[model samples]
Structure formats: C-alpha cells, structure tokens
Target chain A: MTKVKDIGEQGLLERLQRFCPPDVIGDDAAVLVTDPEQSLVVTTDMLVDGVHFSNATTSPEDAGWRAAAANLSDLAAMGATPLGITVALGLPGDLSVNWVESLYQGMTECLQQYHTPIVGGDVVRSPITSLSITAFGQVHPNRIIRRGAAQVGDAIVVTGVHGASHAGLKLLLDPQIGKHLTTTEQAALIKAHQRPQPRLDVLPHLWKILDNSKFKIQNSKLRINNSPSPQSPVPSPQSLTPVAGMDSSDGLADAVLQICRASGVGAVLESSQIPLPTAFDHWLTSEQALNYALYGGEDFELVLCLPPEAAKTLVQQLGQDAAIIGSITSDTKVLLHHQNQKIPDQVLNLSQGFQHFSP
Target chain B: MTKVKDIGEQGLLERLQRFCPPDVIGDDAAVLVTDPEQSLVVTTDMLVDGVHFSNATTSPEDAGWRAAAANLSDLAAMGATPLGITVALGLPGDLSVNWVESLYQGMTECLQQYHTPIVGGDVVRSPITSLSITAFGQVHPNRIIRRGAAQVGDAIVVTGVHGASHAGLKLLLDPQIGKHLTTTEQAALIKAHQRPQPRLDVLPHLWKILDNSKFKIQNSKLRINNSPSPQSPVPSPQSLTPVAGMDSSDGLADAVLQICRASGVGAVLESSQIPLPTAFDHWLTSEQALNYALYGGEDFELVLCLPPEAAKTLVQQLGQDAAIIGSITSDTKVLLHHQNQKIPDQVLNLSQGFQHFSP
Candidate 1:
C-alpha cells in the first residue's frame, strides 16, 4: 500500500542505503580505494523527460548540458577531478536525428570544458526521451571531502549567490514576469536556470588553503573573479582543514540541513549575510528575494565549513567570491536569525525544497 | 528531416562514432588504460518499459535482473573482472515501494552472484520506469579481448545453445504456442527469457587456455558439464591466442557479421553444426528453430574466433559446453552453408537481427 509518493525521494534513498552496503550509498560519489594514493569516485544520475525538463522550456542542447552538469556537480562535491563519463540515452523513435546531434553537441561541449570526455554510451529505444549519465573521477584518498565531516563551531561558507536559478526558472515558466525587467536581467536569470556551472574552479584554491597554515576569514563581497589578485600581498595564515563540504544543488536551506544531519551538528544561518543576486532588487521585494535565496534550488555552488580563522582568510583571498553565511552549532536544530532578532523557523518552512515526490 | 527510426540503431551508432573521439566509442566497453599493466573497462546499458520488458509479462524482479545481466555481459565480453555497478532508476509516483524493493533484491542477487556490488545510484520520478546501469571492471592490458582481431583460418566457436532466449520471449508473448509444451518445458523457456546469464564463468577457462600452450580440439558433444575431466590424459599442443571475441547478445548471425566487419574478414557458418536447444525440435520445425538460433537475439553466449589448434584444445577443455560451428575466411562476405551445398545467402536474410527500429 506504500507508494513512492507516500515516502518521498529521501525516504526512497534511505531505504536504498539500508538495502546496499554501508560504504556504498552515503557520499555524493561512491569512493572506491583503487590504490594507496588514489580512490575512484563514481556517481550516476537519471533525468526523466517530464520530471527533469520539458520540451516546451528546454532545448535538446540545454537538456543535455543540464544533465551533464548535474553529474559533474556531484564529482565537484567530492573534490574529485573527473576521469570521464558514460552517457546512456533512451530516445523515442519519433525523435529527430538533428535533435540527438544537438544533444551530443551540448553534452560534449560541457564535458570537454571540464577536461572530461564521453568515454562510452548506449542508445536504446524508449517511449520518452531519458538520459542516465554516470561520471567517474579520481581523488587522493586523504584529500576527498565528505558531507559527514563538519565539526561544531566551524564557520559556514558558500561560493557564489543563491536562488538565481530558481528565479530564472520562474521567469522561464512565466514570461509575463519578465515584462517588469530589462532584457539583460531576464536573460541572466534564464541562463542561471538553464546552464549551471559546477564549482570545479574553486577546488584548486580550496586545496591550496587546506594545504597551508590555519587562517581566519570572513565574507564581504560577491564575485569569484573580483576577489583579490593572487599577486596581492596578504598576510600568511595557518593551515586550515575544511571540516565538511558539498555542492548546493538543492536549495541553500536543504544543503545546510543535509550537512547538519550528516555531521550530527546544527547550524544558525545569518539571513542578512546570505548572498542574493544583483538583479533581485530590480523587480522583486527583499522578502521575496530572501525566500528565493533560502528555498530556491539548483544553484550549483560550493558550501563549506571551516575554522573561523580559515573562513576569514578564505574570504580575504577569494574577496567577494565567497561569503560567511553562518556557523555550525552543538544544538540539535538548525536556526535562522536576522541581525539581532531570532526568526521563528516554523514560519519560514525551511524544510520545503524541490522534493520530487511531494505533492 | 530524418527521424531516428529512419536511420535505425546501427546508423545512430555510426553517427555517434563519428561525433566522438575515435578511441572512445568502438568497443563492447570503453577500455581506459590507467596503468602500465591494468586497464579499466566501463559499459552502460539503458532499458525502458514496454520497449525492453512489459509489466504484463515481466515481474519487477526479473526486469531488474535482466538489466543487470545486460550490462554485466558487456564486461564479460571484454574479459574484465567487474569492480562494481551503479544503477539509476526512474519510477512513476504510483509505483509501489515494495516493487522497488523487489527490484533492488533482484539486482543485488545478480550482482552478488558475479562478486560485483552496487556502489551508487540516483532515483527520480518519471512517467515510465527506466533503468540505466553502468558497470566498471578491471582487466590486464595484454589480455583484453577485442572484436576487431579475427584472423583468416581461425575457427569460430560458440558457447551454449542459441535462440533459446528469443524462443523464450516468443513463448512468453504468446502462451497459446506454449500450451503444447509440458509444464517443465514452459518453465524452462520462461526462465531463459527472464534471466539470461552473463558468460563470466567461461572467462577464466578461456584465459587459462589463452595463457597456456596451444592445443587442437573439436566439438563432438553438446553440454559444458559433459566435457572430459581435467585429470584425463590430454596431449598439450602449441600455444595460441584468441584472434577476436564477443558476447552473442544480438543473435549469432549478427555477432558473426559484426566481428567480420570489425576484423575485415569473412566467415562461413556451418548450418548443421549450429547448436540448438534440446526442446527446439519437439514443437517447432527445423527452419523455425534455425531462424530463432540465427536471428533471434539476447543469447548472452560467447562467440570466439581462435586458431585451429587452439580451438580444438578449447573444445576438448570445454567439452559439450562449446560448439565449433564456423571458420574465418579470406572472402569478404559472411555466408551460411549446409553439408555440401552453399545455401544462397539471400534466402536466409542473414542481415536481419532483431532490429529495434524496423517495422
């Protein structure tokens, strides 16, 4: 009598974890220690035609790019450099060959950008178009980041702005909303929803910081490239090891909740400090923008927990590229606070994200 | 203006090969040489509802087993020892959780039997059920088998009987035809269709022969278990290497044609020498049975081309488990002949092999 809808996606995942080996199901990617120094990270994601995208909104090329990006983001979460990927496509007979070619073009372009190739694939017949992509990568056994490693008192940091993708999706579904904004603003939001960039670019900087002396850091600005130049003279800080890390593909709140639950810690997110898009004030109320930042999904940004000094140093190094959103706490429940006033968590409905099985 | 149906699956594959890098798309699995001695073999297969298996005919568990077996067979073809597999499932919201649990049970059983565990996966909502499984394995660089290595004068050998799975599928789709069969016969045919075993068991024996001295042998009987015991006195012959090898999932004729095309050689199949299931003659005519053996697909047996002496040795070692049904030729076309007469190649329609897009 228990249907998939009754338990939801999380429930299904928990069931699968119980059914499979303990080490197999918990991480963003399964880490198989292949050698003394290197471990294999493998992850698979399935994208259904109706569930993941629609023909009305997503072109074949964009769909292909989105699918590849999603899997690559998982590898980024594990701090793994991709080896390659295998794409298995189930296409309907009525689909045009040109569409398929365009799809391959999109997928190949995205993969090539990340220095990964499409190493193998299978194309089969189906009633609807679907794609299943499995990406494999290599990471040093000692350097692999895990979601369950966050420590109490660790400062929370996030790369890039949140909720733009969600806002972009809203604009795409309702063109009338775009009438209120300039074409450039509309286009930026739409691009965010259609093409998410995996945070692979930030890994090298993070590893450098992790390898050096511990340092304190804090957030100030927003923009990855706008950060202080590498040549800029900055004070050396002590080496800092990241307590935990993951990609924020789900809404920011969901990402925080997952890290907290996995690490057996709680968090207090400073609402005023959370990053929002530059265009948010152009057309939307501050409260609406805040809601989008908190609950909007598919940001594809990196979320990390580090010591206070490390956070400060990272903020200084990355400049506006990274922000200090919150801090980990020993308390069992996640909290949200705006400046000096504590916000009632129930009113925010922070638990709501882009759940697949929810009505 | 062309649709996928117009080009068909093979045409689509050829197009993909042209689009992808030369080294990435041509093998049973993509063989990535990671180290001097070891190579990684990765393959992916996607199965869709109705197209692959209908809910009316296939239980959820059997569907799971079939999907796993299909991917594992690809690994076996490459002579690789599986490391693990990742499965991505797209299920409808109305599907029962118990159905998914049963599906996992089936996949687990098949994977465990081959010593490969399920490592990671993603499940999402879809209008129809679909499964994509990616299996990765490791093989010795020097020992890997390829489809493009057949040589003239090599003997063509096949493992087990062919067409049983196709016949099984036929029976499952049309129960009226199976009514003439006994209860045991019905069950046997149904089992063949539902659970085709990957030929991983034969890999070690083939490797042993490939590793050892070359020996001449011939097939006289029909059962793998009926072969002479290892303790029996058998003369050792000179060493021989396998020229080419692959699994016969796409029917024996297609397998032969593919090897010939890849290896740039011709072949002559001995019609009378081909292996058929014991139950074939009981109800079906000679021509119908032969048709099933030649063009009916999903056999999941091994088709190998080896030198005469090596083939003889393998036949002796494998006994009734293998059959020598053909030989490699300098001629450019694959032909079928009976005892003395060359059967007109056109009459047999050798090109037809369970094509997906065909009307």
Candidate 2:
C-alpha cells in the first residue's frame, strides 16, 4: 500500500493523466473547441490554509487576490482573454464574516482588474480554509498556446524579475531577516509576496507578436480546408505552431522544465541573463540571488518560448519588461550557460521548485 | 465580529450573491450565452472531509461518485448536457495511493455514464482532503431552464422517491438503524445514498414536452425580433417562461422553497402525494417517512415546475419516474396540504435540509 507521500505530487498527476482522456490534463488550461473559430480554455487551482497561505502572514484580502491571480495567470499563459470564474470555498465555522467579506473584496478587485467576474460559487464549512477557483477564458483556436509546442531553436523568454516574492515570504515568516533591510524595502518585499499581479496585460503583446505572420497563414489554410464538420477547420500542431507557455507559479526552473518535458526538447538557460529583482542586492550574495531567481516560486510571471525573430521583436517592443534568457535545444537535457565558460554548461540543478508533497 | 456559524451556509451565499454580478450567483448553474443558439452552464460544488463525508461512512469511490453526481445534478437542473468537468483536489499525504486511484475511478465511471469527461484538474496537499469539481454544460439558449421561472398555477412535479438517500446515510452512520430492515432493503437504501444518479435521461422528455408548445412561440419571436446585435435574440423572461427547476440535493422542502423564493411565488405541497420509497415501510412510521421524504438531503432528484397541462404530459410520459406533488400559488407562503378535511394547509416546517455551518 503506497502512500501519496511515496509517489508525491508529480506521480499523482501522472497517474491522473494516464486515467484521464488524452487531451484533458496536459495543458495550462483544457481547451474545449466550442466552435471552429473559437476555443474555451478552462483551468482550476486549489489553495489550502496551511499549504498555500497562513492567516498569520496572508490577510484574507491578499489570500483572495493571490488565489484569483493564480488562475488568471493560467489563462494568460494559454493566450486566452478573460470571461469569468467560479469560486468554491471551504471555511471554518469560527472565521469572522468580516474576513469572508474582505476576502471577497480582494477577489472581486483582482478579477475586476482583468474584466473577469465571479460568475458562480459554493461555500461549505470545514476545519481548515481552502479556496478552489476555476477560471474560463476564450481564445482563437489557432492562437492557443501550449506547453508541448516549444519548437527547436526557439528563444526562451520570461516576463518580469523573479525572487522578490520568495524573499518577501521569507521576511514575513522570519522577522530576523527583516533586520538588515530598511522599512520601505521590507514593506515592498512583503507586498510582493502578499499581492501577485497576474501578467494578463502582457498577453496582447504576445499574441500580436506571435499571431501576426503564423496566424494569417493558418487562417488562409483553415478557410481552404473548411468542411461540413465543425471541428475540421481546427488547426493541428503541425499546421500552426504556438509558443510554449505557462506561468511561473511553481518556480521558474520548474516552469521551464515542464515545457521541455512536454515538448520533448532541452533548454540552455543563460545564468547571467536570468532576471533578478534589484531588491536581492540589498542583502543577498550573488549566488543566493541567482538560486532564488531560478527556483523561488509564486512569481505569477509568464514564461514563453518563441522563434528568435519573434523573441527579438517582443523584447524590442516591450523593452525592459521582457528578457530572452535561453534557447530550446534538440538534446533532451536542461543545461545552464556560464558567461565566461567554453563549449558546454553543466546540466541544470535538479533540486528545483516547491513540490507540494516533498518533505 | 459575526462568525460564519452565526450566518450559516445560506446566509454566506446570500452575501456572495449581493456582492457578485447580477447574473452570476442566482441559479443552480450560471448560464453564459455563448452564441445565439447555445448557452454554457457552469456550476461548482466542493466536498470536504468530516463535513460532507467521512472515511468511517463512505468509501473513496462513493465519495467521488457523490461529488461528481452533485455537480452533474446542477447541470441537469438547468437543462444542460454536460460537456466536461475540471476537478481540483486537496489531499493529505498519508492517504493511500489506492484510495486516490479508486476515487478517480469512481469519478470517471460516473462521468462516463453521462458522456462527460474529466478535462482538467489540480492537486495539492492539505491537512484535510477536499474535492472541488466545476462542471461545464451546454444547452439551447431559449430552452435553458431557470430557477426563477415558476408561474402561478404551475404544477409542482418531482422525480423519483425521496428520503431513501438520507435513510441510507443514517444506516451507514449507525448500524442500529438497519436492525428492522431485511438485507435487501438495507442494501437498496445504502446504495441510494452512496450512488445517487443525476436525472439526465429524463431531460430529453422534459425538453420534448415543454419545448413543443412554448419553445415554438419563443423561437418564432426570436427570429422576428432578431437584431444586428448578437445578444439581442436572447429571449427575456416575459418572452419564454421556462419550467422552474433545481435538484433535490438540499432536501425536497428546501428545493421547493428556493424555487418559490426565486420565482416570487408560493407553493402548496400535497403531503399524501409526495413520493417515498417502499424501503421506508420496513422501519419508519408514516410521519417519520414523510419528514425524511421532505427534509432528507442528497436525493439527487429533480424538483420541477410547469403548467398543469405540461405537467400532465410529463407525468404521462415519465409514469412512475415522476409525480405531481403540488401546485404553485400567488400568495407568498409555502404550505403543506392534508389529504382529508382541509380547506387550508399548514405552513411547512422550517427545519429542513443540511446547512453546512449550522450546529
């Protein structure tokens, strides 16, 4: 009798994927082809009381915002525009009504930012608080991004700096860590951990850059291939190659590895090119900062794979907001590039990300 | 300073409804008009350990079946056929892998019966296990049923006998409850509770009956009133009066009250006409059976409202599967009728259904 701990979260997910339908569990969000022209993308994430957040550290409002952002970030990763969401909450009986209301306020405020509404929900009593949010979005079927679509020679791009959230989490959990920082710096780091903004605003730029040339070709091909069957016009992976994408909720390294594994390719991450927030300079060593930048989770930033030209265009257009930190490889190993080293870089550290079941 | 226990589940939902968008939280499922021809109905239900189910009373397989059935029942209430569902799970690490696999097997089996697939999911670690399922379904926009559409003079109808599931739960929790019943009778009742079926098969008959008369008028009106705007063709409540509906997960009496409140109408339940399974005869009195029939939650049956003619047609088509339990009234009160020597019925007992936060 194997316990869930023995197999861990990844093993459990693999078990589910084997049991589920082929197209169901592999993507950032499940794509349901609603029509020939459009597809519906749906994703769900569950946050537990002790596992994801604690009352001592996260305010009810912040918890609500973070939960909403997590789901919204998934939609963004799939290149889908917001529609609405359903929230199912399990709360303790002793929780104050004010706390619940404040939580709603946070969720609503975050959702409103992206023009998404809370469409439906169920509330039940439990010993510990937990929130499960399911977000729905719509995208042109040809334009939907996937984790398995990273082509060889594609540039690996990431949005925003990392590690601030993890640092903030550390600071919140340990007051001694805050002693070295100024009050303003401490407040900024704490805020980063408390309120993560889903990179929904960057989606339009991503689509505009990737969808322009490839999408027009796919559109013409679709028109030529249109048949009586509704799903016949849906472009296949070979017909329209999308940028591999997912949000960095489970740490940057894990996000990249997931894409590589899904796409059956390798990656070369330039250690010097990876973005670390300036806040890390206040106290952390260069190596410590790099480690946090690579493996610290809950960034809520976009990780994208695109052709070099498209990546260049994205970086040129977005300027400081985006970075091309690596490139896809034919080899089936994720490696890192040392700035002054020759030929090869060591295989990237396997000790990465926060696994839910890891001791 | 108010606690969730003070307000209870209903009160918390009311609070959510007040804060959510007008069209968001009012129905068994929120209907999103995707195209002029179709609407997408989405509903979510969360089941928690100790609160909704216990390992002592329920197998993981049964828990999965119950959770899936609960969401499927919501889709049925809205006259929507399921498309797919996303399950977000929170499990404790010490749980056996077999238990988790069995849970998925039960969910998949139940979903497969209705051709609904598991499309997406997320799993996380938690102190207490919980399952949150969000179900997606589709229906013809004009034909979609609503909770707030019961008109005065409409007949109140119910599907299948009630109280069996609640009795089954009692038997599972307390072995003494089975003392008077034969083995077959006990098994039947226990099965009823563990594996309640969603009334999806009866939906076609319902649509065939109700849509034949009212739908034609509404469809013709829609064509004549079709405007350049896409949403303009969506029929208003005045244009198409659908049969008010919901599942009996929260007890028959509570279901009746919800519809009555939503539709701004009163109801008269004929006490003698309410259906109860024959298993009740083995151990329970007539009064006890009636209480269980009216107030026993988790039946997963349908409570419907229709014009007397339509109701008659439905009963004629469904036979024993459905029964005319009562009628809608203009007065704003829900009452129970006595079969003999009664000009007026008494107000229904307010003590009904399972309230999640109540002591």
Candidate 3:
C-alpha cells in the first residue's frame, strides 16, 4: 500500500501547496498587517481525530470545517474581523491524498464564507489525524470584548438555536435512531453537528456599536456571503454586544457558570426562555430538549451579556432566531428558574458541560 | 484516578490561567499590535506526543521547550521580532496536573528567553499529548526573505553548531551505547536533544542586515528579559539573512535541497568548512561524524543564501557563531566537496534527514 513515507514531506506539501493562502506557502512566515488603530486578535484550537470526531461518522471535510469554526468562533466572540489562518496538521501514514484534499476544500469553503484565507502551515505525520488552527483577526483596541466584564444586571441573550448539534451527535452515534425521525429532520440534525457557523456576521453591528455610529452591513462594502454552509444554518444579519461576550461551545449552563466565575457574579436561567429545536419534539420531549439545550456542547452560538435595553433591542432585531435566556445577579450561584408546566424549578448546584477529560 | 473530567474545563483553565500573558487569559482572544512600518509575521508548528517527543525520553518541560522552539525558529528564520505566542494543547485524560504545570514552566522559560509571552490558547483532551504553538512576530515588509528568491551565485551561510541534536537523539534512544561515551559528551548530547533554543538573540544582527542600517536590541525598549535558557547558547548578538532564508530542521543537506528546489538552483557544500560537534571523536570516525553533520535533523539552525558582499559582512559581524557553508550554483543537483584526508568525497544521492512519515 502507498504510504505518506512514499510521497515524502515535500511531495505532500507540494500536493497541498496550491490551497495555501497567496504569498504564504513558500515563506518562513506569512506576512499581514492592519491599520494602526486595530489590534491583532489571535487564538488557536486543536482537534484530535478520534476524540473530536470519528472517521465513521465524520468526513474529513466536516472535520476541517469544524476545526476552522472553533477558532473562528473565538475571534467572533471578540467582534474581531478575521484576516488569516494557519493550520498545523498531524496525519496518519495511511491517509489517502484525496481525503486530505477534500479536508482542505472544506476549510476553503469556510474561509471564503468568512472572507479569511489560509496563510501558512506545517504538516507532519502522527499515528492518527489531528488538526490545529490558529486564527488571526483585527479589532479596535478599545472595542474588544471579554468574558470577565459582564455587569450584574446584564440580560443574557443567545444567537441562533441550540440542541441541534446534540441531537445530531445522538443520531450519528446510533443509526437506529434515524428510524425515529423524518429524512429532513435527520439531515438537519446531522448538518448541525458536522458544521458550525461562527458569529462573525455580527462584526458590522459590533463596529456600529463600538464606534457609536449608525452602521449597516448592506450600506458597507463588506459583502455578507449568504451562501449557507452544509453544516451550518442559513445566514441572518441580526447582531449586538453588551458588557461581556462568550461563544457557547461548552453548552449553555457551563458557559453561564464560566461567565459568573470570571466576572464574580451569579446567573439565573429562565428554562422556559431557552429555545428548543422544532423537531426535537419528534424524538425528545420538551423537557428533554431543554436539558440538551442546557448541557449539550458545540453550539457555536454566542451568549452575550447586555443591559436590558440592549438585550431587548438585539432580540427584536434578531426576531425569532434568538431569545433572552437568563439574567445576571449579585448572588454567587447559577440557578435555573423553570416556569414550564411540565418541569419543576431547581436551584442548579452544578452546571456541567462537555468535559474534555471525561472517559 | 482523577480524570480531566474531574477537574472540569474551568478548573483546568484556572490551573493554567496564572501562566497566561497579561489581559490574555480571560478574553475570547488576545490583542497585540506592531508599528505601522512592520508587518505581522506568523508561523505555526505541531508536536505529536509520540512523534515529536516521547515521555520515555523527554520530560514534560523538555517537550514544551521543543514545541515552542519549533515555531519560534520559523519566525527567527524570517528575522521577525518576537511579540507573543498561543499554545494549543491536546492531552491524554490520564495526564497529571503536575505534568501540565511543569510543561507550562518549560514553555515559560522558552518564551521568557525569547521575550514572547503566552497570549491565548485552547486545551482539549486527546488520546496522547500534542502541542501546537502559533508564534507572532513583526518584520519590515520590504525586507522579508523567501526561500524562492535566492540568486544563483549567492553564498550560503548557516548559524550555530549542526548535528548536535542528532547525536543527542542517538544517545537518548540508546542508553546502552551511551555508556561508552564520556560524561561530558553524554550531557552535551542529551542537552541538545532535550532543549532547543530559538535563536532570538541573533535578531539584532538580522535587523541590521535587513534594514541596511545598524539596529540594536538594547535601543528597542522591548526588554531582553532573558534569565538564560538552559538549552540556548549564551547571548552572542549575531545573525543575518539574505535573498533566501530557511531554518535547518530537516538536516543541512535536506534544507539545501529544499532551497535549491525552491530557488531553481543548486548548492555545493564545502565539507572541509562544515563544523562538527565536539563529541564526534569519542564514538565514531570523522566520516560518520560528517554524515551526521550533513544529514542529521533538528539543528534549529538557519541556512541563508546572500549576495557575496552581504555574506562577507554578515560573517564578519557574526564571527564564529556563523560560517560560510557553501554557495548556490546554476546547476540543479546538490553536491558535497570533501578534501579531508580522513574520507573520500561522495555525491549525495539521497541527502535524507529525519522523515516524519518514514516507516
């Protein structure tokens, strides 16, 4: 069988070099810059093949899309304008050339959708395939957002729907579950888990807020490429920011707890206010759906802490895509307030999410 | 047994938060900036646990040092000024907290030595430990070097000692054979393998060459901040770049081959001029030593092709820290010329280095 050893390092790089960002592949380092007023925003993420995605359930392309999304979401959380990305890959010797090419095609799709390009990278062999992506972006220094600045009375609003990725994972892990839902529902759930849409579309709004000037994406030259990703939802332009900002990948409750701990404040979740996927009722009860929305991970939706007026305005602008799920308080605990007729209120002593080290 | 799940994501972050750069840990992304005259230069590298370093031979800190060195060396190859780094880590669930702490300590030592602090990153669970570091630096846009730009008659120069890491790896892999070596030889070899210095000290000289004007690190006010890294040589204040620049991670000959292939030229190495490690005489003949010097990997040294005048000036300024290794030629094949009485000259058919995917 042909192996990476046969192709050699340079051979493989040559195969993939055309996909690299222009003016990047052949240099010791990629070069980039922005206006002096903008600070460079950077973050990185790594995804292990087995731990983050199984080959049986996820195509190489989906893995690449998700890897780029993870880093892009971090930049989106800061209202940063994405500039470029560098991908470092660890791959198995037996990995086929086509698989890698497809993977990069997926990355290209996401980067084009977001308007950022791949800069430069290193590829080496490992026992299994894994990916590490570093995303660089730009933001006005004073306009940057952080998770530790949420005010006690800020209203917590989230972008987009939740629990779809969790449902998708459940289906991917068990094909038998596919019998319980329609083909459309199954496809939607699978897509949600495989693809994540970063909140970068909100940047134009963020600019408007930070600059205290009326701004509209339609009025600006910045094009909103509305081409929906196979793994993500269709685009909607509603966006806003508050005292603090966080992109939820570790589930809703855990994110609340994280913000509370970071800001030394408490949080209260209105369980009834949390949005549930419409088809979740087909296989899951309303209560179970809320639980999945609460504790399931990989949402990529943003949870923002804003004043009551800002939160209300953002929700109005976002229409039904978002809801005010919670509020901050001076108390030092995160609690859930369930007003639903089907569920009882509970003072959540624990807000757990995806555990990286969980067996 | 405590799992990473036991500590929870936030708990793990808390353990690492103290080591983060200022205003970096709590944010969605870290912010950095360089003056308008300079462009941001970025590079990334990944170290798989078993592939790059094994726990059997490398301590957590050594692995950390090596990982950071890989990326830092890329920036150094571009003559970029260090600014910050983001390290994404993938770790096994069974890893100890102490191991992680110690690893960060090693990264801290390397970054402090290079004056690049940790900015931001994500830590996730994987089957084994793997680290991905993103190094961000600043460089004058007009002066940046590329491997494809080497002139046919340019003189090639290399910095620091070569093949020591290879000798060190040999010792590390076989302790039984190591018993034959002197203690001084053993220590030096092991040190070379375990600790890699990124060569940031040579930056001032690089600045001088690139700008065509004298520049001193002391005048920048960026702060040297070096407490001395165990793996790095003492401050020598010497470095340079030319029309083409590449770091020697894949042995001298392989790097030369890469430059030749990129620049559409050839190279000729003067075997008599190449430097050998001090311990070569203890275990092998001069021929074997020279082979290692030519074909061993992880030297973390830079090989550059400069105009004759620039090469002469840089060599004079750099003194013994660098040497004129060879010259680029119009011919396409890389050749080695040896006039030494100990060995006959040989045409290198395969100037192979450590192959990442070799079976």
- Using lDDT as the measure, which candidate wins? 2
Candidate 3 chain B worst ten-residue window by lDDT: B24-33
- Per-model fnat list: 0.73, 0.83, 0.31
Error of 3 at A230 (Å): 44
- What TM-score do all the candidates reach, one by one? 0.87, 0.90, 0.76
**Of the pair 2 and 3, which is ahead by lDDT?**
2
lDDT, model 2, position B149: 72
Query: A228-274, model 3: which lDDT tens digit per residue?
Result: 22432222332222347778887877677777876778988887788
Which digits, one per residue and each the tens of the lDDT, describe model 1 over residues A51-147? Answer: 8888888888888888888889999889899888998889888999999888888888788888888888989998888889999988876567778
Descending-lDDT candidate ranking: 2, 1, 3
Give the runs in model 2 whose Cα sits over 4 Å from its true position: A175-186, A214-241, A340-344, A352-359, B175-180, B214-241, B281-283, B341-344, B349-359
What C-alpha lDDT do the candidate models reach, one value each? 0.78, 0.82, 0.68
Best by DockQ: 2
DockQ for the candidates, in order: 0.54, 0.73, 0.14
Better of 1 and 3 by TM-score: 1
Top-TM-score structure, candidate number: 2
Error of 2 at B308 (Å): 1.7
- Runs in model 1 deviating more than 4 A are A178-182, A213-243, A340-359, B176-182, B213-243, B340-359
What range of 10 consecutive residues in model 1 chain A has the weakest lDDT sum? A219-228
